[model samples]
Target: MDDSELQAIRKARMAELQKQQGGASGGAQAGGSAGNASNDQQQSVEDLLIRLVRSGQIQKKVSEQELISLLEQLSQQESKANKTKIVDNSTICELTFPTSVLKVKMNRKRLLVILEEQIYIYSLKNMELLHVLPVRSNPRGVCGVCQSPLHPFLAYPGNNPGEVIIFNTDSLEPVTVISAHKSDLAIVSFNPPAGKGSKDDRLLLATASEKGTLIRVFDAVTAQRLYEFRRGSMPTTIFSINFEPTTNKYLIVSSATETVHMFKLGEPAKARLRPSNSETEAPAASANKYFTSVLKMLEPQRDYTCLRIPTNGNTGDTSSGNGKTKNLGSANHINREFKSAAAFCKDMVVVVTSEGYLYQFKFRSPEFKDGELVQQYSLKSM
Candidate 1:
């Protein structure tokens, strides 16, 4: 059946299940009886979803938000207490901790909880506490989890500055550790796995340091340096780093500036395995850098295309404005003057700003070099 037909079936089945459960909840007694009925209702919804998946009426890799919406619908008539715990039904698990949570990221199989100083990994099947990893001062809870079920990896900051620890969530062990930069890390992201699911495909990770001048893509399995894209010379806080969802060919980076950069990942540099404590520069390299600084300036890698959102509304200047582009660098705890984020959503480039504006641009295919502003709208009430 087509997706729309399958969705109709899912809605009909869920509505039928909701009606039956709604009638059952009416006569439920208070205290333990009400709790038992609530649990039964949650399980009934779960069973209905399972049958739909088995019957090929629902795709296993559907959006998590849609599943959560369905779960909330099932529990909408339950007690307020039960409604609070609806996430348990959607995720098939729940976790409680003594400390406040810094961040939470999950996929189909595992749930990762980041606290102030420690990280917890748990199985979604039974809420089994799998691993507890001690980390440094991660107040931002910087962590990247691979969404692909086949390439089950999780990346979090290591104990030292700019160190990234890649761990295999499936095997419950460490994969590799990469010292990505000389300064502290600001953002860590993994490229979405290729849609074709090849056995030879290795996970690719992208990291931006607090320096913010450059973004490095690495081989997650081998701890090798692959490609580095120079954002700019000036330092600014990077807001987001996102790889295109399906092909993983293009990377979108947003920062303190109004412009959003999209880099097409062409061929990468020769993979060089990083050595431990390799911070010192060689004499020949130092001499070359000094001469390049004194005589000719070094050329940095340029972005394939960029979109600069108009500060005013649709009447503002639409051109991406020419000049030397800046890197998405660190603001060093300074208040961001401006903020924006960009990502590839289907065939269009989507940009959203903190000033309450959403912009969409369409790019010509094949080369994908230029962008045409197709839509713009204000998110705030004027």
Candidate 2:
């Protein structure tokens, strides 16, 4: 009886030890699998961050301490392949100028850099000095250049308050002089042709004055005012004004005031038709003014520092037609002012803020009740 009982207890004890050892090994393998998964995720994020930095999409300087902290976090995961090392071997190519650069614009194959009293044109291919154009006391570097193939010219505020001088970029010669306003000129722009095959005969020129009260459009070929609209009675700075591409059916205006205005262009008249009976027709003096009318005035839910509308003929209506505001959960709270904005796609806009945050706003047309927040990216985190 004693020997059989002792052998049975020994067999059961041996099975218990084997089962416990197997369970411990299984737990260790599961923990290792988890670590590998984390390492893989960290590696993916590192690669994307580095690619954006090299492409100049993410522009920020990371502190040494912050970079070291990131590296330590990556190394904590048990994978040698995921241990990322931050490198600062970026080489910068700089173009030296005698004076401080005020504005830089690229047109076709030329690089135009505006300086205090002169505008320097450089070849884009090799950065060779092409020409140096002199100007009269341009302290603010207030100038605009047109890149349209139909009517390509460079314009800047003239010596007089109400003038603008247009210059041909190729010939380096003055094309024409325009007496645009009674007050100083603020900005000048030539309408961009709708398409590559479009004609330039109907292209128009837009100008804003320092008073910021009047915005006028003139025929590029005839140099005659086509229409004039009043912005506001109180003088303010005009941030930007753009005409819709191709059709010229709409105009977008932004000013110092925290509002953006869209105006619908009226149909052009070739000739004023006379009534069959002169008595039935209204007198010329009593006719209604043929100015562009404001279609919509938008004040963004979050105040923007800069705003822009796309003129590439791709922007169309973005309304859902259901009259509902799309709810985008607040993952990234925008606490800073917007610095600039541009059209990203047919119904999307990309806005950059002063705090180095990039926001993508979808459903962003005058037709929409509210712009839908699609995505938020922290550029500073890079």
Candidate 3:
């Protein structure tokens, strides 16, 4: 067909498509007048392009392929600009402490700031110091605070290595003092109410010693031991420990040894293999031994300095290594160590590394095999 005939056919086809779209969006047009206006504007733009082509004002007839390519280029440029954008974080108000601030915990009502040997509790609205409580000299900055609406409490490592002193946030009085471990306390934290089953009413406390060989859980109110899980014989720093928020069925422990340990809680003794079972079935149970097997150890694609456990379902890979057949365990291929991590959803986690690279991992099981890495962000320049 000649140019005029081809242009006429194309114009007719475009008009037909626009009519179909308008009919399909009639319900939306009724619900939103702005949407109808937008559609009208888009149709006008298309008509303008056809008119320009007919008038010979535009020398070139831009094909659909060329338009698509231009759009893709513009999208890529916009994405690049977004990725390189810098964020500014300037100081709003400053609160001076007698010593360096170790950690700060806040809720809607109060702000608890931890110093070298004291905790200053201030009103969130007024910033007035309501109470100042002295704690053991914490040089390593080992302390944790939680102020959940269901169960609120403050915890710190005691002067003695094994002791953990619990205090009431409202009364500023001692709730209970318990000997948690033989070695120095590394960290102490109160697990928020895991919103699952009948355990929603109970708050659990988790503690790790300075040696990092063992992690113990206790009933926060009764001060009764619930579960004890061993990390390893070797002394390592327990970077962070988090309980699954929904079921409390598992606990994730991240350590300096470049490992993440997942432990199944509330399992029967038989489920957790005994020494006798391991001795009798050495070859069969070797892969699932008591201490080593109970701890489902996971090494991330990169060394993770911190991690978060999902609450509702099993959401990590169970494969052996980074989904590669060759050079599976090679040290040269692993990613950089992660500095911190938090749960983004039931199946995804957001991780930040020491070098300021952020990664999101989505998996299907606790073993975290065959997982998908969604996006990686760098904030080093900012």
By lDDT, the best candidate is 1
Compare candidates 2 and 3 on lDDT and give the better one. 3
Residue-pair clashes per candidate, as listed? 4, 0, 5
Q: What would the TM-score be for candidate 2 when compared with the true structure?
A: 0.54
lDDT of 3 by residue, 1-382 (tens): 4546644643454354333322111100011011001111123333443454355542333332222211221111111010010111322244555465555555446566666676766555554556666666875556556656744577776656777766666655556655688888877766655664644556778888879888887777656566777666788666566665567665666555434555656643334444543346776456545457445321111111222222122234322332121212322213443233232235544333333343445534465432344444443433
Clashing pairs in 1: 212-329, 231-327, 232-327, 236-329
Question: Comparing candidate 1 with candidate 3, which one achieves the higher TM-score?
Answer: 1
What is the TM-score of each predicted model, taking all chains together? 0.65, 0.54, 0.56
Query: What TM-score should be assigned to candidate 1?
Result: 0.65
Where does model 1 exceed 4 Å of error?
Answer: 1-94, 197-200, 271-300, 315-337, 365-369
Model 1 lDDT tens row, 1-382 = 4546644643454354333322111111112101111233345444544454466543344333433322422121212122112143243333455565555567668766666666776656655566677668876667788988877898988766888877777886566667788888877888776766533365789899877889888888766666778887888777678887667777878777766777777665542222334358787776766665533222335777766666466433343423233333332325545666666666776665656565766654553434556667553442
Candidate 1, residue 280: the lDDT equals 88
Candidate with top TM-score is 1
TM-score of 3: 0.56
Q: Residue 250, candidate 2: how far off, in angstroms?
A: 2.1
Off by over 4 Å in 3: 1-93, 196-199, 267-344, 363-382
Error of 2 at 96 (Å): 2.8
Model 1 scores worst on lDDT over the 10 consecutive residues at 27-36
